[model samples]
Target: MEKVLLFFTAASALTAVSSLPARSFYFVYEPKNWTEAQSYCREKYTDLATIESMEDVDILDNMKDLSQMVYPSDSYRAWFGLYDDVSSWRWSMSDSDFYQHDEKEFRNWRPGQPDNYQGNESCSAMYSDGSWTDVGCSYSTRSVCFDVKGPNSTFVLVNTYMNWTEAQSYCREHHTDLASVRNEAENQKVKELIPSTGINWIGLYRDTWKWSDGSSSSFRYWRGLEPNDNMEHCAAIYFQDSGRWEDWNCDKKNAFICQNGFSQKVVKLKLINTSSVDLNDPQVLENLLKQLKQKLKDQGVDGDIRLSWKKQSDGNIFMKNTEDIGSDRDVP
Candidate 1:
C-alpha cells in the first residue's frame, strides 16, 4: 500500500509539470522589432495570444507560472488583446477566432479605455491595474500565444482585381469565396499570406458580395480605374502584391488570383512603383538595379529587366518585363 501511494504521488507531480505551460511558450525569447516579433511569433510560436474570455487571459497569465511576472524592462510597453478600434476586438494573428465576450466578470478593458485616439490605433495592451489600453500595432512587447483552430478548417481563396461574377466563380470553383476579414487578427493573417510585392484584392467591394454571415465590403482596396461603373461589386486578393487590396467590377475579368490550397502559389508580383523616379539620382538607380539584379540572379534566370517608356508619348507609360511569366520559373 505504501509503495502504491508513492507511485501515485510521483505520477501526479509529473502530470502537473507536463501540464504547466512554459513561459517560453508565451513568447519567443529572442527580442525583435515589432513587425519582426509578430512575424517570428507567427512563423515560430503559435499565433500571438488571443483571448476568448477572462479564462483565456487567466490561461495566458498562468503561462508565466514558474517565472516571476516581471515587468517588461526594455521599455514602457506590453502587448494587448484588442485591435481595429471597432466593436470587434481581434488577435494580432489572422488565424485566431474572433473573441466573443460573454460573462460580465471577465472585462479586459483598460481604465478610460479604447479611446480610439486618432482612429489609427488597432491593438490593445494591459496596464498595471489589469485594465487594457489601446496601443499601436507597431509597438513591441511580449506576446501571448494561441493555437490554430482545427485540422479540417476550411480555407478561402480570392481573386484580386476581378469582377464580382468572376470572383464568385473563382471561389465556387476553388471551394471558397472572397475571404471575409472578420477582424484585425484575420487581417494580419491575410497580410501574412505572402511576401510584399504587389497589390492584393480583398473581399471588400462596395455593398455587394456580402457573405451569408453578414460581413460587409465596408473595408476597401480600390485599383486605379476602379468601380468601373458601380457594378464592379466583387473583391479578391493575391500575396506577392504587397497585400494592398483593390476593388473590381463583378463582371470585368482580371488575372490576379489567390488560393488557400496547400500547394497553390497565390501571390502575384506587381511592379506597381518599379519606375525609376530619380532620372538623375544615380545612387537610387544603382540600388534599384542591384536589387533587381539580385532578384533575377536568385532565380538563376537569364532574364533582363526590360524597360519600355516612350519619351513624352501623350503622358502615358507602358512597360513590359515578362520573361518568366507562366514559364514555371519563379522570379524570386
Candidate 2:
C-alpha cells in the first residue's frame, strides 16, 4: 500500500468545517428478537450496540435509567452486542491492520490447544514463557494489559484473579485489555510482564464474536460455559450475573443496549502543503490541519478523515530529521 500526501490549495484552504459529533447509544424497548432488534437499531440508531471494552459495557450497564425514561417498558431482558456464527476461529483483536504483516498472526498455542474442551473453552491464558492454551471463559486468572500511550508502550501485569470477563473489565478500566501482541517484540514485552507462577489472561478468544454494526472487534466477554449449544445462537450481557456474556435463544427478547457507532476507516495518504510557512511549526501546523479539514469537507470527505500529525519514537510530533515517514531511516 502506498502512503498518500494531499495537496493543499492556498486560495481557499482556510474555510470553516463542521465538527464531529459525540457518538452515543440508544436503547430501543420495542419487543423484538435479536435479528429484529438489530434491524430496528439499524433503521433507527446505529446497529446493535457494539461494546468495545469494559467502559463500553459500563455505558450499557448504566442504560437502565435511559431505558426507563425513553422506553418506559417493564421488560427486564434485552440483547446488546454478541452472537455466534459457528465459523472458524478469530482473534479478540479483530483489527485487520494489526495482523496485516505475516508475523503478526503468530500463535504459539500449547499442543492439543483449542480443543474446545467440553465445547466451551473459548478463552486463552499464558503462563511464564509457555505457549497458550484454551480455557473456559469463566476460569479465574491474572491478566496482562497493553497501553498505547504516545510513543512509549506500557504493559501492565494485573495479578488480580477474575474470570475472563472480569479481567477484561479490569484491564480496560485501568489499561488496555489482555495485550494484543502484534509481533514477537510485543509478545515478548507482554510475556515479561507476566510472573512465573500463575497463568495470566491474554487478548485471544474464538467464537466468531462479532458486533451489531458488522464491525470486527476481537474482544469477547463470554462466561466460562458459553457457545455450549448452537441452538442458543444469540448473545446477551448476563445482567443477572457479572455482566459476562451468555448464549440465549434469539427469540427471547430482553432489554438491549444500543451504542453510538464509532466505525472508522483508516486511510494512508500522501499530501503536500501549498503554503510557504513551516509545516513543522505547532500553530502553523494546526492552521494547516484546519485548512485541510475544511478542504476535505468541501470535497465531501468530512469528519470521517481526521487530519493530525504523527508522533515520532521520541514522542515528538515532528521529527528533526528530514526523512519521509515511510522511509527506512532509523531514529534513536
The candidate maximizing lDDT is 2
Residues 1-332, model 1: lDDT tens digits: 01111111100111001122322225333434333433444455433333333443344344432232132532212232111214444322222122233311233454566554544344544343333455544444432222224422233333244533344345434543334344444445545553344333333221122321111113443344532323223342211232223333333322211111011111122232334353324454345445545644675533233322222244422234465322121100
lDDT of 2 by residue, 1-332 (tens): 12224433212232222334555878766667798888777667666787677877676667654334232332345687677654444444443333556655577787877566655777778868857887888998888877754434577888779988777667766774556666677777877778888788887776545665644466787778775754676887765455678778887756677665464433332344444545456776676576667766776542255556555577544433354522221110
After TM-score superposition, what is the CA distance of residue 81 in candidate 2 from its true location, in Å? 2.1
Per-model TM-score versus the true fold? 0.20, 0.41
Instruction: Name the Cα RMSD for model 1.
Output: 28.2
Q: Model 2 segments beyond 4 Å from truth? A: 1-20, 65-75, 88-207, 214-219, 263-309, 313-332
lDDT of prediction 1 = 0.33
Q: Local distance difference test, per candidate?
A: 0.33, 0.63
